[model samples]
Target: MSAPAREVRDVARAALAWASGRRADFALGEDALAADGQVDRSWKPLGELAQVCATVTRHTPPGDPLHARAADLLAFAWRQTGEGELFLRLQRLEPFATYPLEVYAALAAAGFRHPAYEAATATVARTRGWRLTEQEPTRRLGVLHAEERGGIHRDEPREPALRRTWLGGLPEPWTFERSAGYALTHVVFHLTDWGRAAGGVPGDLTDYLAHWLPPWIDTCLDARMWDLACELLAVAASVPGLPGDTVPDDAWARVAAAQDASGALPEEGDAGDPAAYFAHHYHSTLMAAFAAALTAGQGVPV
Candidate 1:
């Protein structure tokens, strides 16, 4: 590698290492760290270490609520502030949920941009949990409304009108748990896109290839069993009966490069399919080649 390329890679490595160390410390639980440090067990450590980890993870953007919370929670966890362990624990209960958002915030601070921001927003719509309205043909209730208080209903065989309201009560805790995994994956996808752009465009694909692409491909797989979803979505959009081709060739190229000929993706033509030679195959192949031409090692082309 050239001096500049080596330098960039080294810097990225250092940042990742620092971030990973902070994450590990937080995972160990701040109190445990302090107790081990022998600071006196008479008082709770109040998780000062945890807060520092959070701040480092997010890079502490100015005026962010999370930033403020991290600070307060750190103080409380360490017993430096009035807040207690109960409150601090409650506040940071969903670091996974916060993680994705923090990644985006970090990217912004580092000057990364993404063309898929809108596409990502569409994916989040699935998380909103809406009732399926519209008449049902049989006994299945056609309309699904948020549970009503003491709502009286007759079990009917035919389609019913649909309605939806807010899900009430303390809210199912698992709802957040289930959603966090999916949400984090989505967030990671966006970051991967940004990384790909950064690494490929300006002349540095190494970071993306070594650090980002593997999990990035996994993210796509998490979204769908096969690359077919994106391909299908594209085909649907491209044809009259479908959504109509909205995503540009550049976007398609990124997706294609993530795949391989064997369908396992991440490598060159590993799978063979004569049918793919047509629209699906050609699209992926063409876009990937174009991406390759832009300048390997740099990142996404402008």
Candidate 2:
């Protein structure tokens, strides 16, 4: 392997190691069951952990160290969800809430099935309440993906949902901003099922992404938006034959340099309070691991 490729793989490995070490910090709180209490702090992090670990397991061949690390992490995360029982309870607690199913989908995709939860969601999926629920285009796509993984038939066709997104318009390149950047990355993510289905990205959108994604990556890096930049990098890797290298080695080097000794990546230029480290840096660290894992799938499996 070339030096750059190996370095990128190291980034993936280190980031995953950091995440696995901090698995306990991802626990849900007492308020998690309350309607006012949300999953953003607790369930969100665990779900992100599950999602990235599953993605790593998906891209890496079995028996590889990275695959094993990710698998172990996935198992730990599944246990955190009470072996999928928490989702069933969450569904019963909030029948109309989609986050439980959203979080459940990641585990579900990685060979972790919850029959009771799936069965309950299947019945809910047929209800008018679930069908007519309003979500922004990106979230709508997420729900569809969750439904697919949860064994609930999709409430809406994906194509229309795709077109409704900010990235769907193929808007003026100059109009891109912070929120748009994230929205665009997620649009690509959901379209490709977190890079598992590259063909899900349309030819036109793929071409557009190929042409424009590099600058967006560079832009994020320039602003030190490591989390979103890594996310954008994953989008680039998700597209097949995405022309020249989507992120130049130096950019990858910058990302690697930004990584802490423990393998966690900061969301911005500097790591903030140590006490709040997980809250501030978990997502970006997860993104780095995710990008490296997906990129590693391109040539030699990492």
Candidate 3:
């Protein structure tokens, strides 16, 4: 296997093992269940697990046991909760939030094709109508809205409007700033579905990513922001026809180097204490595995 592909495979294997081992940290337990038989609003870990597993399943090889295991975990979580009803209750409880929409998107991405999931998704979509216009000040919300629409609905309407919003250019004075980098990467991910829908990305937008991504990756790595750097790698992996070298060969290597032997990557280089393992590591490790799977899946050479 090529170096990049091999790196992806190794990282993915380690991440899956790590995530599986840490499932108890995120999985719904009896104590988390509501006495009233409603989905507990405090059980945020379920959503996190759902998204993580969904990413794993999406990028990992088909027929891999991890895929099935992740699916089963998602199903178990959903069932343990109130399923569609829980989502509805959650939506009513927390309107104007993007997380419920994100959960539906993750389940859909993972190929969970239940009617209840579909219904819950449609409810959320209708409730949170497309917030993709430039007027939406929180760029992340716009990106999240786009992700739900494109990832779940597969309906890329308002093409001209979307082009106007994203293709106009990234937020001005872009730097290695962490939040800015994350917002930029998420906009690209929503546009490209983390490389699964590259044809949907506009030429100008793709060019914009191509121009800024390399430097952004370098800056984030230099800063030891492993999670954000992995997200930038994911953006590079998404742009179609961008040369492999655009994503530095050591991009994945740098992220892998930061990972603990148990496969968790701290949010930053200095936060690797085992006592705070799950709190510090899940997001970055998940993103690293996600980047690896996404880049490798594209058959892109490093």
Residue 141, model 2: lDDT of: 88
| RMSD vs true structure, all candidates | 22.7, 1.3, 4.6
Check candidate 2 and list the clashing pairs. Answer: none
lDDT of 1 at 225: 28
| Native-to-model Cα distance after best TM-score fit, residue 125 in candidate 2, in Å | 1.3
> What global local distance difference test value does model 1 have?
0.28
Candidate 3 Cα outliers beyond 4 Å, as residue runs: 28-45, 65-69, 76-82, 113-168, 171-176, 272-275, 300-302
Model 2: number of backbone collisions: 0
Query: In candidate 1, what residue range of length 10 has the lowest lDDT sum?
Result: 141-150
Candidate 1 vs candidate 2: the lDDT winner is 2
**Higher TM-score: candidate 2 or 3?**
2
lDDT of 1 at 168: 12
Instruction: Summing lDDT over every window of 10 consecutive residues in candidate 3, give the lowest-scoring window.
Output: 33-42
Model 3 lDDT tens row, 1-302: 67766677777668767877777676655544244432333355566566656665665566976567666667765664566455455555654455555655555565654465445545555543534333433355344553564234544454544544433445454544766676667666666654566686678666776777787788888889988988888777777866656777687787777877988888888655768767777777777777776776677442
* Candidate 1 RMSD computed on C-alpha atoms after optimal superposition onto the true structure: 22.7
Model 3 RMSD, rounded to 1 decimal: 4.6
lDDT values, one for every candidate? 0.28, 0.87, 0.64
Among these predictions, the greatest lDDT belongs to: 2
What TM-score fits each model? 0.18, 0.96, 0.78
lDDT of residue 260 for candidate 3: 77
